[model samples]
Target: MSSQPDLFDRSLLRSRRQRALKAAKPGADFLLKAVSADLEERLLLVNRSFGTAVDLGGHTGLVFKAIEKSGKAGQILRADLHIADPNQSPPDLVCDDALLPFGDQSVDLIVSALALQFVNDLPGTLIQIRRALAPDGLLMATLPGAGTLTELRDSLTRAELEIKGGAAARVLPFADTRDLGSLLQRAGFALPVTDLDTITVRYDNMFALLADLRAMGATSILHDRSRTPLSRQVLYRAAELYAENHADPDGRIRATFALVTLSGWAPHESQQKPLRPGSAKASLAEALGVRERKIRE
Candidate 1:
């Protein structure tokens, strides 16, 4: 099989993440912490416990801390592309987004938050993750969906096209809900489920939104991103368009973040499987108390 296309620059991604937490302190990673907390809360609703867990691409250990608090795993290991502060707890493994340093069928659970969207080879990463899981092992992760930053993406494209007579990629691509499910199945995971939640945040202006993205280490890092700096004229026009199109009643602009949550399990004989066709004992018409008409062969 052919290899997956390289989409992101790993070194640049690591630098941005390091810079984002350079002024690190309590609550510095506010947005990441919020999403990690939400993901952990939802994971707990599944009511499953694991003996060993790994938090892949866990920036600043926020998601790992959440996993620790749930008491769902006996031993929790942290992995990421960057090494965290020495004063803080160090990670168990430091590696690239698409690499996994674990034995096959060893981990009982794996959790990632706001990280997989940057992976250059998501299908390969998912396959590695599935291979690392023990039988019936669970994987729970959340990443920004396709609808994230729609307003900004639209505004930027229009402004750049109008000012420069062309446009370069400013926003990175996101995974669609169907694509996530297909990847899980392709990776040989069982009982996969994927869903999305929309979170709308209001910013005073487009600059504020951009700054927040920068602080969160979420700015564009696509491999094909434009090297030249954006012109001030384009930036100003983009801001004006954003405010005009997505402004709230209070004059603040609305930014939409669609978070996609995915859950899947390592294949196991005990897990539920779909029955074969023509095996059902009851008919839909009978169940609904309606007449059933058969077409002549």
Candidate 2:
């Protein structure tokens, strides 16, 4: 068995997602829609078409729809924890993000948007995804990066410290872009790349931001989160702090969402490989027209 400590409450996350599904409205999934469009744009840059594609953790079918619209895959399947009604649009499979059902080298492409951040064992999940892809197949995913929800975290921490003399974790910790890139390399993906996109959203007040978070099912699900409900006093104080610290001149507060996109391909002999050390014929000193210095023994 793996010895990694569990950082997220998976059960609570599932419950929250299910609740979001029931309460979802037209614009509640704005983030997902944006990410899906970005994924499609990236796929358009590739010239080849895929035989089969899997939309892993494609909540509400937005990513699946984006993949379908891209016309880059012959067959597309959607997988998620919750399945829609049989009469309505339903996922091809219902499964957890940590456990994928595809066979080895079976899928030509896999896309996941805004779903990998909640995974407790992200490295293992990436390894599974790499194994599931066919040779030279591609994986593209988006995850919330370290800069997301910074203003809210600071406001909540300060308010709780001032009112209750202590603070509990109110937000989920996100992975760093560099760390995620390294994880992709460790998972046996070739030509791994990670890039960040920061989107600043303006809200009238802290309450508005909190409502959006709740509607997105993005409230805290940390395993170490405090069980006691936040008192109204603390909530009001948090709002006050948020307004005092993060508000703009027009009386609007700003929230940051850092989306990190990761892309890599399953290893194949045809892919480009880095040159071996000491294989270059020309020396750096000669190339730069400078004398090389040697350290004294």
Candidate 3:
């Protein structure tokens, strides 16, 4: 990727999340709900319990609730950028996503869902999360991958260019799976794993899809977004294009959402380690019953 100025307006993103939280209702955020479910499923695979855990960017406390129900942690702390009313269980902290209010290596576990993608400095944020985790602590998170919202991004760009004569950045560029895994290693996370989950949702039309995105607070917060509101002509054209290109047999358009789920752990003495090169005692050719040949240098 070429060097560029920060693509996202983080302040605007925070405002959007705050609005979404304020307007929260049951079943409003299907994506977050899905992500939380996936997070909980991953948590279930781990047989160990944490003494203390923190839910970073815990929007609407969904991750917190999941951790609570699983009983994976004796105590869980919730943190977010918005000042949300704790209602029953108050959040342990409320601050910017980039800022961690905990001591270094003090947390036993950290989990986040559908939040890290909006941060301006995702690498820096991951580094901070790694620093906050106690030795052997686990980190599990979900973020929109490179393939997320491909249909909408394409339709919007073509529509904008056709109607407004020029297009502005409409969708934030997402991190590639390989890059994310590399970032985890750079941040000192051990046994880093990155995988993809593709969810295809059907919408009656583009408007319905757009509404879902808005409710999820997933609208574009690109720093270079067009200052002018999207004109009706462009909106209509986009809808037409979306249906023409992505419509299914039932006429409902299909929207693809690819989520990158990552899991990593803090380095500890007990964790599994890779064997050094040339350390194996047996030869692969002998084990496989294949002819072995050596070339003279």
Candidate 4:
């Protein structure tokens, strides 16, 4: 048996980040501006003054426009596998692992969108996020969840099996909401919350979506045996499978992005110091709305 190569190498992360930037022609500065404005609203709800924001794994400058519009971005920081284009300066780009970065309890809010699913060490990354947050600070992040790219995955599998003897060795893994919430809690975040949003995008055809992915630099860098190129035949068959099986009416194909957004808070010393023993303990039966029963030894 042969050992599998690391799919989440630094080089691979940088390549993906670069691809994401090249491919993302983010529509509407107003849109990202709206997102920035909403961060202010969310900050109010979190009951914390916005001090600083970090864009973890942020590929392009879409979020920076939002920060600029927010007018509350004096200390906004952008950290990713690759830095932003040097000409743009609103976001001070630092290339580093999202799981680790500068200064402890220094940031008031961290907004990471469409980024966490790519990290191999997600829980560790969350822990790092907690460390970056000030007391009473919040971390808001969105990640790809299960059910995202199911069609593409299915088609790719079919193509690989038909052409090669087995399935493709590499594919991105997404986390589920429950697991993600638990991870945030383990990372020492309090009041962890997870919400799911499903966005269905329509494409003229399957090939169009594939092209969009390529443009978005969302291509796979995890070629364990990338020397084995994806032949035209396999790509054609994959397209056929997608158009035939995954098409909607009007001959358009659909792609679903299952985005799971998570939020958590850094602990305040006052909040932690007030807990009393057995203050909120409950039996499993009580918690689950079932009658308690004695167990036999």
Candidate 5:
């Protein structure tokens, strides 16, 4: 087990997710809908079908629905901290994202959408996922990347500094795309790939954006978050700052959501491997049709 302290309040996050599900309104899951479509598109590109697929931390089964619609996998299972609706088809596995329960080489595919970002120990979780996958099994997931919510982060920081004389951690820290790619390699995944897609949403004001975040259960649950509620003055000032800095000509403020997609396969002997350093058949100079200039030691 890692000795490092938890970055997010997982208990709080679970409760917040439950609350959000109870109060969810139409259009509250717009981000999930967009991510689900992207996941389906990516899955469609893969030619082969999977025997058993697990939806890891899939909120409200959007990713599961996507996978089912694609007809790419058989025996789909949903796993989450809690079932969003007991009346509906309950999740097959109710478990935390950080601690997966599966035998070695058990699952053929795992898909997660906008869920792994809140995990306290993402690297460990990735390792566990890799261990749970069959040889050549695939993992595809999407989460908010480093550039997400920059406007709101800046506005909140400035506002808090001006009003409270200091700023606290108001936004959750997101993983960088390169860092996530490196993690896939570290977790022993083969043919790892990471890509970014920026989604910009325009809101009438910062408050509207905040409301949407709350509805999505995406509000900050950082373990070190300030206990005191944000003052109305600070909130209004942040809104004003957001408009001044990130608003469009039409007076609508823009919010950025940087989605980072990750894909990798559990290592297998049949997968492609890189050639040895000196195994190239043709020299670089020959390939480029240029005279090689050696660097002086």
Candidate 6:
């Protein structure tokens, strides 16, 4: 398939996120609070094993709940596209630019949470992540993958097509497990590991789930949003359609989150490299009687 314009673009998605935050403020907060434990576990693991770490796309420090509490790190750098203040500063904060402003391989570990999906130049970003890491440094991050919001998105699209005559843009674009694995390989990481976790939460209604997205500061941020105020007509229509078509039998809505976690090591020169084409003593076909037959067949 052809690559998408902002499919993995972070800046574009980051710009679109504020709207979602505004719309689902309460929900995003609740959702992040809910996932705080899991995120902390991921963070703690990063810290205990690797003393000095850098948090990329480290929005508001939601993921690293225990950073300040621990006396472990010599320093932990918290980086983001935009940060209000360093808060405490030693594990310094820097707003993002086109590239990471750090010396090569200076970081011991890299941690990012729910941030990879927004990157447009994903491979390049991974390469940069690699470059930022010291030899044997670890990179751990999370992103949304397939099966996220399946019910809501599918119902909304169906409802719009049936009544509104056209469908709205996608709520989010997510890669599947296989796609993520391939991306890890392409990024030149050693022993890349990718896995998915399915989290299902029940909501009083559709609005509740939307709220979660807001508090998490993870809402859709398309470059284009019709360029004008969203007409109440569209808004109301969207809500009505969502409720009518997606409501559960118990009157509760279900929101599903598929999170992909990736772990990788920067490539080391000591690792084995594939041999040159003619470096082998003899080709297998030459030793076997089927040599000519293998070539012809």
**Best of the candidates, lDDT:** 5
TM-score of 4: 0.79
TM-score of 3: 0.94
Clashing pairs in 2: none
lDDT of 3 at 148: 88
Tens-digit lDDT string for candidate 1 (1-297): 996668998778878887777755454466677788987797678777899988888877788889988888899988876556444577888877687888899999999999899988888899999999999999999999899999999999999999989999899889899999999999999999999888898889999888888877789999888999898999999999999999998899999989898899999999889999999999999999998888862
Tell me model 3's lDDT, rounded to 2 decimals: 0.86
In order, candidate lDDTs are 0.87, 0.90, 0.86, 0.68, 0.92, 0.66
TM-scores, in order shown?
0.95, 0.95, 0.94, 0.79, 0.97, 0.74
For residues 53-118, write the lDDT of model 3, one tens digit per residue. Answer: 888877677788888888899999888765664333567788777777778999999998888888
> Candidate 2 residues 109-185, lDDT tens each?
99999999999999999999999999999999998999999999999999999999999999899999999999999
lDDT score, candidate 4, position 98:
47
Worst window of 10 by summed lDDT in candidate 2:
81-90
lDDT of 4 by residue, 1-297 (tens): 995444465567676556556555554122233444454455445543477877665545555445545555457777654556533554565656544665798888788766666566677788888988888887887667888788888887798798876876434667788998899889999878888777687778667777666655555655353557677888788788888888886877778778787888899765645458768777667989988877762
Off by over 4 Å in 4: 1-7, 19-45, 67-74, 223-226, 269-297
Better of 2 and 4 by lDDT: 2
Better of 1 and 5 by TM-score: 5
In model 1, the clashing pairs are: none
- Measured by TM-score, the strongest candidate is 5
CA lDDT for candidate 1:
0.87
- Which RMSD does model 5 reach against the true structure? 1.6
Measured with C-alpha atoms, the lDDT of residue 275 in candidate 5 is 100
Return the TM-score for candidate 5, rounded to 2 decimals.
0.97
